[model samples]
Target: MTEKNKTTNNGTSRRDFLKSASMAAAGFMIVPRHVLGGRGFIAPSDMLNVAGIGAGGKGQSDIAAFAKSGKANIAYLCDVDDRRAAASRASFPKAKYIKDWRDLLEKEHKNFDAVSVSTPDHNHAIIAYHAMQLGKHVYVQKPLTHDIWEARLLTEAAKKFKVVTQMGNQGASNDGTRLMAEWYDADLIGDVHTVYCWTNRPVWPQGIQWPTNKSEVPKELDWDLWQGTAPRKEYVDKLVPFNWRGWWDYGTGALGDMGCHLVEAPFRVLGIQYVKDVQASVGSVYVDEFKKGVFPESCPPSSHITLTFPKTNKTKGDVTLHWMDGGIQPERPDELGPSEPWGGEEGNGTLFIGTKGKMFASTYSDAATLLPKERTKDAKAPQKYKRVPGGANGHYAQWVEACIAGYGKMEVSSPFEVAGPLTEALLMANLAVRGHDLKGGALKYTWDNKAMKVTNFDAVNKYVKREYPAGFELKA
Candidate 1:
């Protein structure tokens, strides 16, 4: 038995303490707050104990947000690299530090109420799936999974396990998304038929050959553990601390990195689900005067992909979403003044084109505005949905509260049910981007959502479900 389930000197286990605390008001007289502890004290049982996996970079901020919620206690921290995990370990000095996530989950599952997965895109699904199987609530970072099959599996797992799940696309809980939905519902933009979501990502290296020389593994890092689900590879510099997004082996390119944030607005506003078909055009890289670089392992420096979704209850016809990365963007709408920012002050944004008008929002779906710029001034829509307490910042707390309330009690903004479809849509777009690199791959690829395959291109179908290394295989 685990330490948490062991009997205490008073003949009560921690489980028993929790059960009794839950039954306190029903089974016995309630004591006043002042008599119990003090004016603003919270019982230990009321707190959600969270175990953090990948405790560095985005992982660090994710757990810090949960702790900021005041109802969540950072119970454990796990990371493969000590250097990357230094700050988080210092911040949560009391949290049990573990080097391997598998060890933490296998040995300490009973100690925490939930798990936060902030690892690379390739490992997101496996970690989250395992945690869900163990009956733990999970909050995973964006692009939920590297492949479409994994997203679908996790979506079904959440339903089967009946656990509260949330994706780390905090923008789903932002007021801008809700406001955009309100405008769409109000018919302010009529029926949206097209959306353009663009980003200036791949800020990392892309369209390049893999490093020919391997570097010595850093003493503070566990190279093997870091390559968890990926096939074994020699240690290389600049892949860690954030350049992985450019490689197919460990990252999902710009589409996977920023698609969740930019496309989420349209998904929430238009009620879009799985994609119907996709096609793409990508910029080429030439190695020399006569030779064109064909690096299959790396993502293209730039690409423009188009995804089509069948008509939903919210729309009159099919919807077309254009995804552009590496600084590509759509043509400027005539409705906007020359001085007005196309997608906000930033170069990245999502634009919705409806029969009546056009609307757009910047990254994180912030600064939502109607085209013609002036239309935004007179736009008014009835508040139809309840706003999250702190908007985008409330995302972490929202999951914490819902987990404490138990599954199906409270709602989270980016639950797996919704995130699954959104993520699959982006991954589908990636199929087209990757296909662009193959022979006769530039043509449109028809998608069979039910089968989760590309009906037109057999070569691209292999990417729908990636093969894992031994001991890391994902079971259906």
Candidate 2:
């Protein structure tokens, strides 16, 4: 069992809590809201008191969604940058505010029943793990963690802690994923041996050297807290709010930003669990006519990655999933008409190429349609899966209600069990992306998922489990 579940803040192990709660439940009948109040119903007195870390930007929207549910009371807000957090502070006037998440979780953990972490990729696992250790239900934004080791650890931690957990890949709750699954189960697409997911991301700056001129850290922002697990470095111009997605230290690049949304459907439809190997080719930037640029700190402007997943029940053989980013896209299928839109105008989508036919969907699994226009127009399949009410938008309330309902009593669309491996797949793919920066000519990185290392390139394995800064270790 994980240390988190072995002993909680209340001095009661999850096993103890279960034994006692079960005994209590035997004598006292606890009625679920769906039975006593009704679906989408919550008693005001039983509202879930939520604490949000990184409560700004996407975090702001996440917390707001919980508030909109009316069953979640935003009890506390935390963010390193006051400038970015201003909107959320004003939105939740009654929420007590703190800048450091460690302080928030340490001092105010009991004040809130659950925690929402929407921070950068680097610090996600640490904060989320601590919250779970406190026996608090957790809602973490996607890509789950910065490294493959962290992803595997968090996945195991969630099950061991016996805590209700959810990854903020809202698309997991989308009807589109279910619809695609229904079609696939009906053999509409037959066995999907190949899949393609692409996105026009890194809309931010990438594939460049770090700014030589370091900028002054904003007075309103606590740069140290923002850097969390990342090594201390001088703050640069405009790194806050969003551009961090392009950096290797703080973000997971385009794949981290859109992979969960774009790759989730294929995972669900094909039952992909773990990736076996990965290889990538990245777009390079020209610093000048005389020299090729090499910036190890930033993600490339674009990349095309290939991941091989072992055979699953849904596939006749192994599956090869292609991931492209930075405006790179796959060739239009012949079945698609000349004028038909490819992967949608949003410049992000997933296409499943199977033995019998092909299916495509936009990011977040929306706008799913069978290819060959005529086939989509003529196809019909039985609904074999239950659709999440409100689809992607329901992801927030689903967590809120589940938190209030207690662990194991409620179901979430993107629980750690599913999101964990999906995230590992993305991170493993990233291992190849980062590996491209190696001095060697080229190599296909065979992944030993069990060992959490790239078997072919020992040098690149350093990125699989990064060294944490002092006081920021990830515990099992």
Candidate 3:
């Protein structure tokens, strides 16, 4: 067997593949690894090269994870913010650096087999799509896209291009996510019908009035690139470095920021979907003196959203999920831990209101304990809740292996199929929030995975497509 056949998937062999192909004068321009794999016993490492885009926030941490990754070595670090770039590049002085991610992808990214994009949700699909087109695998952050269409596009591209992928919720790999899934399967909560999940969003910026012409752009930022697919706006200190999560143009608000992680448990373990009915109320919030329209003109600081899943042909039963953010939580169930405090807060977790018993959890509830802790001790585990085997290892490390191995274990916990659907669901919550604003009532939705947008909503169709600012565009 060739050396490439037996080695584990770390990606160093990608260079060898390209070298041998070049020597043979094959004029190869990056074929999907599976094409070569079927002919011979090529391993994933034969394809593991890597680059990064948006090395800040989640992106920066993703870079750190890549640095610590044993499967594949870091080859590049890309970020728009010099401050974040300088910080991330600090560990891998050898990795290449650039301000514009395109330059890295179009010109030098061939050196990489995969790229992790930790940019805001708005740019996630655009950069990830282009990367897949160039034949590189992708690791995009959670709440995968700012809008629903992007989620579908990215998911399809991974399959069409046959590239391995992961969404950067990282939390998805937590023992808690698995436990939540297992619990659902084991009937631990027995027919979970209602779930309450929440987060403290608007943690950054909220209540943006319509944009005015006066905010001064921060000198440190490349406001243009940061604006990437969103429409142009004057740079403001309020919107840079970390605070944009509250804005519609740059972030997905609380739902987009935390839903992927917080709501992830139910989506995966319970198999909930087809969230057909949504009614929400956004609370009061404000735009900074300098910033405007970056967020909704009149936004709520906290909102409560109720989502209903239809008992369609595929659904076993109906499920309703309620989301609360910005310090608001679904009214505490006065019955949790009867021995403990009544009207207790969920803090940040999903509480399953099941038919048989109850389950209380924290967002970090990967190792969550059941309410009435004594009940869990007496309870027996079931088959569906059987521990999902494999890759309890780090998130970035698994991607490294996939990028290197090419196809073995191609399906990881957060692959596009799973993460993409979760992202779509979370983005739907955002849509519901906005729909409540304009429609003045509950918004109904039907998820057509192929279309990537709500099957309804003609006028809101405008909300689904993202428009880019000057210069930065989704590359072909």
Q: lDDT per model, in order?
A: 0.86, 0.84, 0.66
TM-score, per-candidate, Cα-based = 0.91, 0.90, 0.82
Task: Report clash pairs, candidate 2.
Answer: none
Put down candidate 3 lDDT per residue, 1-476, tens digits, no spaces: 34543213221122232223223323327654445443232334443546878876667777777656655556788877787777778877777787767657655644667888888777887788777776678888877888777777777777877788988776666676666566666777677778888776656657655446567655445666667777765665556677777677778888887788777777766776546656677775324566423244333578888888766332368888898888876665645543564222435667777777667666544546565567767766553432323333477777776677674355466888788777877777677677655663355655454555566665555666666543344422
The global Cα lDDT (0 to 1) of model 3 is: 0.66
Predicted candidate 2 versus true structure: per-residue lDDT over 214-324, tens digit per residue = 788788987777887888788898888889989999999999999999999989999998999888999988889988798999999999999999999888899999999
Q: What is the lDDT of residue 374 in candidate 3?
A: 71
The 10-residue segment with the lowest total lDDT in model 2: 9-18
For model 1, which pairs clash? none
User: How does model 3 score by TM-score?
Assistant: 0.82
Segments in model 1 whose C-alpha atoms lie over 4 Å from true places: 1-45
Q: Per-residue CA lDDT of candidate 1, range 377-419, in tens?
A: 8999999988999999999999999988889999999999999
- Cα lDDT for residue 21, candidate 1: 26
